[model samples]
Target chain A: MAEIVGAYFTSHVPSIGGAIHRGLKQDPYWKPFFDGFPPVHEWLAKVKPDVAVVFSNDHGLNFFLDKMPTFAVGAAPEYANADEGWGLPLYKTFKGHPELSWHIIEGLVEEEFDPVTCQSMLVDHAISIPFELAYPDAEQWPIKLVPIGINTVQHPLPSAKRCLALGRSVHKALASWKGDERIVVIGTGGLSHQLDGERAGFMNAEYDRFCLDNLVSDPDALTKDSIHEIVRLAGTQGVEVLNWIAARGALGPGAREIHRNYHLPISNTAAATVLYEPA
Target chain B: MPSELEPIPGTTLFDGEAARKGYALNALCFSFNEKVNRDAFLADEAAYLARFNLTPEQHEAIAKRDVLGMIAAGGNIYYLAKLAGIFGLNVQDVGSMQTGVSVDKFKAMLLAQGRGESYEVAHKEMLNG
Candidate 1:
């Protein structure tokens, strides 16, 4: 059976991609955020997992309002990243793990969680940025990918509770897999910042701190807040923390946090990176 | 009866109601992902916008480059971002535009929040103290 090695929770703010492209990591404004990743890189070097199952939200790149799926999982042989209208340079294509993706899709269905399965998906910065942050210099990415997109764009989003359940189902699927691949679950997006409305620049470090603490010690406690409450406490875009909640959920109970870094105002976001290993 | 969500101040929920209203506007912005579409839109803005079934208000909002106006006309920030990019406006630029602040001031506000200098955080500290 495949073993779930750990989980990573990160913020996928697109500007980070631009900064990397411009070689601005040491620039005073971006240094703190960039500084958070070296530890993650060292950890990845130490415990190399074979596959990464990423939980992220697409920012109008692949899916549109024409047909938005609450939850979509990728089963493609390869996933490509293209222009997201901001002129961020295209990233190298990612290899996929179709066999595991299919197993997880079936497991989600059996667990009463319906997910749209995609055999051809174009990943956006949400997946690309985090991968780049984790493996900054890889000529070719070391791990296979299984991208799971949760809808954070439109309202009527899956509750944090529901997202946690989805992650647990993923855990079950990975545990039951006939192969022995080591897997890491990644949840990308948010700590707290709103990019629209009169509250366009809203940032809540206090709420973000609360979430960071609770995400590890008491994930269920974090889920107690309804979607509306999360929007109020975090900001509108800050609600991307749903990706974090789902990633934490996949770690199962007794997961210990090994490392965490939080920095604010990373291009209209309170960026954070957390790594959790199963106890 | 379906319970209504209590509205958050200065925030639009982008629920079904807004999604339905903004479909054409969002669809138009979504097309900007391609360089050809971006160039086409730049060449003849009105004609390109006309290709979509945009509401009168949405069309006006785009014409004026009014960020808040676009939001009121049912634009989701995610999609509006693409349109903003076409005009070389980043989030901070539009943020300052909407908030009646300079870009530097808007950025300073964010830096203050990061440093725990915002009113909300200060108020919490006072209460706790």
Candidate 2:
């Protein structure tokens, strides 16, 4: 059976991808943000998960408002990274493990989750940014990917309780895989920062820290938080916290936070990163 | 009637109803993902919108460059950002437009809240009455 080697959570702000692409990592404004990833890099090197089941939300790449699937999983051989019309350079395609993806999808559907399955997709910065951060200097991504796309954009999104349940389903699915593979689960976006309305540029580091603490020590506390509460306090885009909640759920209760970093003001976001290992 | 669902103050919920209303306009905005399409739209705004067969309200909203109106007309913010990008408006600029404040003032309000301001209040005051 496949073993889940590690779980990680991080903010996938597009501008950080811009800094990495334009050779601006050393710039004073971005250095702190860039500095947080090296430990994560070290962790990835140590664990060396054969595949990463990434939990990220799309920012208008494939699904426009027309048919926003609350939970979608990519079951393709390769996933392309595309320009998001924001001038960021496209990264090389990441190889996908379709067999493993389908295993999880089947397990999810059996468990009553009903995740929308896609055979092709061009991922936006949410997927690309985290991929770049993990393997900064690779000619091609060194790790394979299975993307779990969620909807944190439009309203009436899946609830926190539902997201947590989905994560548990993902964990159960990974466990039932008969193949001999090691895997990691990753969630991206949020540690408090909003990107729209008069509340644009909202960053609550204290709330972010609270979230990080509970996410590690008492993540169940988070499931109690409602969509409105998160939106009002964390800013509307803060709904991406659901991605993190799902990752935490995938890691299961005994997973301990191994490394964490939180930083502020990265292009209208309060960024954070954490790694969880089975305790 | 008075029993209808109450709308959240200061926000537009892009739920199912709004998603249906804004589908065509958003699809038109989605087309701007390609640089060629963005350039085409910029070269002739009305012509580009006409291709989408947008409703008069959506066409008017696009013509006026009104973000809030577009949202009211069923425009998703993420898709609308493409249109906003064409006009060199960033998130803060959109927020300023939405709030009817200057960008500088809007930015200052964000700053006044403090970067580390943890939400101490309960959900009732923060989300609804």
Candidate 3:
């Protein structure tokens, strides 16, 4: 049967792509973080999952104002690569597993979480960034994907509570899928810090640490906090922590903080690589 | 090439007023009428600016509609489309409406028909950016 053999929590900062693409890794400032992330790179290379169910918020490519779903799963077979300004150097289309994608979609719906399904779409960084760095070649890293686009970009987005509930639903949905291949659930985006206006340089190491600590043990407390609290502490866009909570919730209490790293100088926010569920 | 967005069909996008509020809120901040809303926003630019730690030039790009520059300024694609919609342009089109046409071909058709006859402040990228 299909199983979530593993789960990963990461921060997919777009500028990181800019930094790496520009060969900034050797730059004194960014070198440290990349050093911390290599083990994560190795883990993904090893797990080599059959499919990656990604959770991220669009910066606006796939869904726009006409309609934005709090949560949408891509049932599409293909997604085009977008030139996300800093130039997403690695560009190749993402292949979606329509069969598994729709199965998760139907399952989520049956669980009462109405998720939108896109048959054709253009995925922005949310799906591409980690993907580019994690899975560069189609033949080797042939992990089909199921993208769960969250509305973290929009305000009054689903509450931390709602997102966790949805995560729990995802756990149940996948739990019942009968397949032999292994799957990896990845929650991309966030630790503290807001990168906008006067808040551009805001960094909350205290909150970042606390959140990471609880993520392995008590996720409900974080998920129960109001959006207002999350924004007040992490900045408005920082609420993307909801994605982290959802990932933890799906990984269930079986998760272990196998690995954790934080680097904020590159950007005000923290970047971490956490492994959940012992294989 | 459909007359309207095919309704994304069965998803509950939101419950009741939630979706409406999202659209209205987005429109209020990013729509062409942003100026009208700015009076209220301006009352407390500090609070507004604090939400997004943008540089002055960055703020100007968003206010000015330098699409590409705005993207570099840290703006996302959705709000960019909202800005486009405010300028009487569709999100998919480029310099001339004739450039990016789709099912809403009529909107593009109407836009291309009026080409350079009239202009809006937000329509000029070089002047603004």
| Highest-scoring model, lDDT | 1
Alpha-carbon local distance difference test for all models: 0.89, 0.80, 0.62
Q: Give me the runs in candidate 2 sitting further than 4 Å from their true place.
A: B1-9, B100-129
lDDT of 1 by residue, B1-129 (tens): 348878898888898998999999999999999999999999998889889999999989988888888888889999999999998888999888787677877777777677868636532333343
Q: Which candidate is the best by TM-score?
A: 1
Comparing 2 with 3 on DockQ, the higher-scoring candidate is 2
Q: Per-residue error at B64 for model 1, in Å?
A: 0.9
Ranking by TM-score: 1, 2, 3
Per residue, candidate 2 scores C-alpha lDDT tens digits across A1-279 of 778998988898877877887899989878878888899899889888889899989989878775789999999999998656656787789899999999989999999998999999778888888878888888888878999998998878888889989998998888888987888899999867765543455667667777888887677788886777777657778789999999888876678888888777676677888889977
What is the Å distance of residue A91 in model 1 from its true position? 0.9
Model 2 chain A is weakest, by summed lDDT over 10 consecutive residues, at A194-203
Per-prediction fnat values? 0.75, 0.30, 0.04
Runs off by more than 4 Å, candidate 3: A136-141, B1-129
- How does residue B42 of candidate 3 score in lDDT? 49
Best by DockQ: 1
Tens digit of lDDT per residue, candidate 3, span A180-236?
668888888886644433223334556777888887777887876666667766654
